[model samples]
Target: MENLPYGALAALVGLSGGLVLGLAARLGDFCTLGALESSIYGGDHRRLRLWGIVLGTAIAGCYLAQAAGYIDLSQTLYQSVRWNPWASIVGGLVFGYGMALAGNCGFGALARFGGGDLRSLVVVVVMAVFSFITLNGPLAPLRITLFPQIGAESSQNYADLISGLTGLPPLAIALPVAVLCFAWALSYAPLRRSPRRLVWGLLAGLAVVWAFVGTAWLADQSFGEVAIEGPSFTAPLGRTLIYLMTSTAGGITFSVGSVIGVMAGAFIGSSIRGLFRWEACEDPRELGRQVTGAALMGIGGVVALGCSVGQGVSAFATLAYSGPVTLACIGAGAVLGLRHLIGGFQPG
Candidate 1:
């Protein structure tokens, strides 16, 4: 494994996990917006509970992996970057509102595109472009000036904080929290009844852990471009697009493989389910709204440091402070956006 090209190994690792995510999205109907809509408007908790399973499983797997010395949390970007509350709130809210307008987050857009929704391709392209603009384009200077992503003075990791506070190993604290979440998810009888959803949720979480473990190993074996990371669509999508245009100069990376893997997996899943078909936006007004939403998602995701799956699941696995705060803001923003859509934002 050490002799393998770091970039190639990372891409393969990302591709393998992304395939699992893509299949889950298409067949299991695993989606953040869908879950929020179903739980809020449709009076259903199954999808939300499914999300819980994914979170719990991710937390448990990541912590356990660290305990086994399979990965190093400090090396991951999530842990290295300073946790900015303002950035999290502003970015999460913008991203959430954008998701409501676009009808999907970046990850969801990719998954939808894979299922033959050509409209989603527009969102994906716009989102990726805007993400790059904010991440490294002209906006980068302003973003850095305002948000200044420096490493935390004190360790920003939850596990580290707990370990220091209580003099208990971080794993000791993490395992219990993970178990509690898993228990809550399992407590929902409806979710348990649908074994397929449960399996997919678990697999999605495991995918995050697997990415960290694989990438960490590569980095340890050969210190190169390999950065310990997991699934995140915002910057990755932009990087993938750039790589496509400049193949000679650009090297394949985990992000590139993850993006391709999701589409490929979604394609397979859709084909298997006989749900593959060509679809496009026929309404100009709808297209306009999606483009606006996509732009917001791209900028917001970059500012927030991640989209839903990025912070909500992947960062959460690392127990980063930004995860829960950003996720809460996103959920709140989604609720507000949903209300505006459903009831014209008028209060009773």
Candidate 2:
């Protein structure tokens, strides 16, 4: 392990975590838009309830690990970056609406692409390209001008704030939150009956914890050469594409490994479930809509500094201020977009 490059080790950590997430998505039916769509229109709440299990487990696992000194939440971007409510609200809404139009978030697109959906491949590529465009390309200057991402003086998270206010340890405040999440999830009888879903939800949460812990250790060892990050599919997807195009110019990192791991894991899960069938978009109009949505997602994710999994799960795990607000806005925007599609923008 000492002989291997630090970047390679980071990639290994990302790959392991990403594989678990991919499996969770495929085998456990964990998804963002799918959950919203199912609960709102399909009259199913099991998947929505599954989110509670995932959030509860992730929150408990991450904060407990922090309390044990396994990782430092302060180093993660969610805490390190200054909190911007406007960015979270606006970016999340745009990203969520785009997700509704595209039929998936960046992470979901990768998972579906892994299942041999050629249409998803298009989404993945377009999203990656546009993410880079917004991140450092033509749109970067305007984005930065609008929502500057300066560093925070202290950790910007709910746990830290509440800890300071109550004079209690962060873990003390986080535990009950975790318990509430678990209780909410278990309250749903259908979710309780599905052992497979419960197990996978737990594993998915652990995967986020693993990323933080692993990368934190690596960052310490590497003297900050490697960033302390978790599973985020926006810029990471662009990084993977860049590495594929210019391996000589850039080295493999956690982002690259995670992006590839998702596809591989999705393929494996699809194969196991006999769901790996080649699919393509036959409608040019549908393809155009997906492309436009992907572009919006890329731009919005850049502004928000995360996709659904990034802000929804990873940031929430740390109890960051932006997490819940951003997620709520994303949900609202998704609901709006879904209604627009379902109603064809007609007055009810």
Candidate 3:
């Protein structure tokens, strides 16, 4: 008896996700662009390092939850065996480059948007539209023709691939590697000094992790047969766009719900904190950054299948091997964009 209101389950996952997102967005002031801004301009490492902690905490928490029978990790979208490494890795690299170009990762894009950065709205739209086109829009056929992936019979995990590469058990590699990453990020002295920001960072990161685990659990319960979906910005942005255009055909996804919730949460938090700035861009340069960044995010997200927070951090924390690969590639691309790609876009 396949009697399940998966739709409601999807909404529940979204609600829980929004609860956590609202709390995190308000408390932490978390954003990849903000982190980069701090690193580049303020010489502060607190935010960036906290991002690492957030991911680590979430990964640890999600895994523990799964081990404790609180959730089934296998039910999520990422767990299904699908072949598309080029789409993931190469696309991740492009996405990362876009982040550099866009000046914010996925989470940062949304966070910035909520904080009254109207430019971020442009970025979000480009990201959503591009993702839709690639996922199932005009370019869908091109994806089918060009990037035909072949995954192992029932898995798309890079952990298995890592084992083959290094001849170590997947867990053995994943654990030590993740731990090392945590240590490396926290090792930065400036980041260690800002205990307050660090705490907020930890809270935000845990929220990101919790959002996914909580959703997976709800998804499982909703269908009475584990259904897996995680919190991501890309699909939700697309969903938000789609719902606007095709209201009757497809309903909003959990991802979109999380995004909307985050916005509301951020807005609420902003109002309480007196941080709301309902202003638009007067600076053309800023506008350019927003638009360019948004387009890059759109195109890059399509290739990679998610944004920095979506696939890289959130997805990777699930111990999905491709998640890490996407993260690395995205980072690499961002570096390149920052290094060589800024001058071309003139103020418009």
TM-scores across all candidates? Answer: 0.96, 0.98, 0.83
In candidate 1, where is summed lDDT lowest over 10 consecutive residues? Answer: 339-348
lDDT of 3 by residue, 1-348 (tens): 236455545655675666556556656666665566577657887776777777766676666666667766555556654646787777777777778767776666666567787776777788788777777888878876877544446545655567788998555655665676678668988777767556766666566656666566655555544246566777678877777678633565566567777777777767777787866778778677667666667766766656777776677777675677777787777766776554564424
lDDT of each: 0.88, 0.91, 0.67
Ranking by TM-score: 2, 1, 3
Candidate 1 lDDT by residue in tens digits, 169-227: 98998888898888888999999999999998999999889998989988887764688
Backbone clashes under 3 angstroms, per model: 0, 0, 6
Estimate candidate 2's alpha-carbon lDDT, on a 0 to 1 scale.
0.91
lDDT of 2 by residue, 116-182 (tens): 9999888889999999999899999999999999999987999889989999999999999999999
Better of 1 and 2 by lDDT: 2
Give the winner by TM-score: 2 or 3. Answer: 2
- TM-score, prediction 3: 0.83
Stretches off by above 4 angstroms in model 3 are: 1-5, 22-26, 40-42, 149-155, 158-178, 224-226, 244-246, 283-289, 341-348
* All-Cα superposition RMSD per candidate: 2.4, 1.9, 3.7
